[model samples]
Target: MTDIEKKEQYAPYISISRDEWKTLNGALNFSLSDEDISKLNALNEPLNLAEIQEVYFPLSHLLNIHIDFAKKLYEAENGYLNSGRKRSPFIIGIAGSVAAGKSTTARVLQKVLSLWPEKPRVALVTTDGFLYPNKVLEQRSIMNRKGFPESYDTKRLINFLADVKAGKEHLEVPIYSHLEYDIIPNRVQEIHNPDVVIVEGINVLQVNLSEKHQGPQVFVSDFFDYSIYVHANEKNLLEWYISRFKQLQRTAFQNPSSYFHRYATLSEQEAIAIAANIWDLINKPNLIKNILPTRFRANLILEKGSHHFVKGVKLRKV
Candidate 1:
């Protein structure tokens, strides 16, 4: 590539093509069973051995290297201060548009990171738990604006991260159920003594944690040891979103107790219409305004092509 082309391609980052990324996987020794993929992948998503070998293994190894470097930094800082400090859970924020596969990436990394020689325990948490409950959104007259930044309890979420960073154990975070389509009342998830915490959500990379954020002020991203933003074309995301909606209609939505059960039996055309409307109104707006704007903040980015195959990996320049 010419210098101008190379500069344009990798400005602000060092970009690697899929073929180049694949070669880095040679030293990775790991495999996932079919059952693991079924449990971790999103509805209507496809994840095969080739995808793991070509994309995730190298990615996992890179994260491991980062984690090691962070440990050394922590020790050095403590030494300089002449104080003894406990190692806190390494926090990783995974951000992307809905149906962009951030959840699957977070889960896969959690599993692979656990298997590293360090045997570090990993905990995965979705910021959906930090979303305002349905009643709160309804009262605020933003039920239609659910995925927007204003739809979340930003202060509480920031406090939760603060606690986690302070080395607190057995912290209780609310549980959100996709099946129920809301936060489960009184159902809590405990984060206890994890070596790593993966926080995934549509707004994980929000440049500002709160509306009142001012110059040189603290933001939620301040707590992340590493952040990744998954990227794909807008057309691909819409297709994936609608496709997953159909899959859920056949599965989760069919359950009598599911909040979306009403849409389960709709005809294909009807289902498509509703899904498209939702994308146009809610998901897409939030992506353009809140999520996509934060993409430049991530330490690494995984760019996907058709069928959710990662075609490029960009590591931010130091």
Candidate 2:
């Protein structure tokens, strides 16, 4: 079936009301701890914690259940069929448009999931690492399309995920700098065997698993035990993007070596214009063509309201 058709057929195995979602932790009376609240407060942009509780708590509970089931399945299959081999890390993919707060979501999830005794070593890797170097993109004359899928080194990303999921003892992922908007040379992040690995990006569940691709050929998400798509209205997302851009103009964009340094002193109106132009020209198109189209492929969908609170969650039927 086509991806869209498959999404149309999706039904939730467990339906939760907004209130029920917040109380998923039984008598523990689910509440964000002071540390978590502090961390959320430290975010560059605003986030609604109550909304997160209502939306992500139930999702986390569902993920914990899935993790247990996967572990059981792995033990049964490996013990009986393959004579006992250790299963690799549980993988989760988080995808959303730019400024959709997906990075925050991923970080919060890494923190919350790690709190679970069974999954202590949660690791998060962003697909930014897979982006092609700016010099290469400039040479190819696609610098303006940097965040688009074609600008990423998909094969290398796939291989890295493959090795990590295969339980390779140590794996190194290339590092990319947001300030420079390019791959940092000779810099790598070491990932040991993590209980959970969360991969976040604009196109994690992109539904591009055609047969022609092979040799470490599994899509980045083929390794996912669970997947989430953070959803918000296009208008709100655009505004958030503009706001973030203005903030960056004062911060990272002010550095002489930063790629966007030229815009550091732009007037508020001019900065907004530039941000809007970039969003309209590049980000919006990529979202429409690549990112938003895959929302339904996610195992869970966190739908955010105008106030930026997760209003509900749609869980796919098993």
Candidate 3:
């Protein structure tokens, strides 16, 4: 049987093929301009008008319903607490393997959600900000495992989410610079009172951490109102990662101050070889050991086909 025929195999997720999903896009009046699409798409990722019409518009519509429901829930809870309070930001987590297009999904969701009829204020916070500084990683002897769960200051990340979920205003979040590939010391990105916040990272869907002896085990996932996992077939992800590495060589790596500057002068084949090795040795292992294992935890799964087109989406039945 085909995947569609075997939909029952993946319980709790009603599998919807691209064509089936597109059928739900009834007269949704949303179109992003070429410039906007260019800004939102990741390097070597395909995101055009067709994707917005068929995939994202319906996705955004569903989010609008969820956001509205969340608002009402918050109001009821506040009444029970006997404290007059505004609704906290509806936090959404986006996760997937490296180069699986989570960043693009996060950015696109942030933009699309903000444009809804409610015109809510939306914030996008990447967990990259919570990664331990380079010095700290080196001290921990985990520099080679930069993107692993151990590489993050999970406490700080959890604290930030807690604050955001508490409706705290003018909070500070650490800033990460991809060009430098490190956390900038004393630099923070301020989040004001946003109605919705999208938390994007590879590990967002993973369970929270705590010592067994600790009291209550609070996980990062506890703060999420909804979560998305953007995944591609393993083969497609490897190819996309290599393609991104080559593009970075032509672009970002050319900057002398770039963390990957040494790769700028490499021949195309040479760059691909190094990128492939990195994928095989570092990224693939982490994906298998950490990221992919957490996929089932996501409320929504966007499964992409070759060249980054979302071919299917699995929405959790519950």
Q: In candidate 1, which residue pairs clash?
A: none
**Tens digit per residue, CA lDDT, model 3, 234-262:** 99999999999999999999999999999
lDDT score for candidate 3 against the true structure: 0.89
lDDT of 2 by residue, 83-138 (tens): 65668888999999998889888887887777664646888999999999988899
Identify the superior model by TM-score, candidate 2 or candidate 3.
Answer: 3
TM-score of each: 0.94, 0.89, 0.94
**Could you tally the backbone clashes for each prediction?**
0, 0, 0
Residue 89 miss distance in model 1 (angstroms): 1.6
- Local distance difference test, each candidate: 0.87, 0.81, 0.89
Candidate with maximal lDDT:
3
Sorted on lDDT, best first, the list reads 3, 1, 2
Off by over 4 Å in 2: 1-17, 27-35, 40-44, 209-217
In terms of lDDT, the poorest run of 10 residues in model 3 is 208-217
How well is each residue in 102-122 modelled by candidate 1, as lDDT tens digits? 988888888878878778989
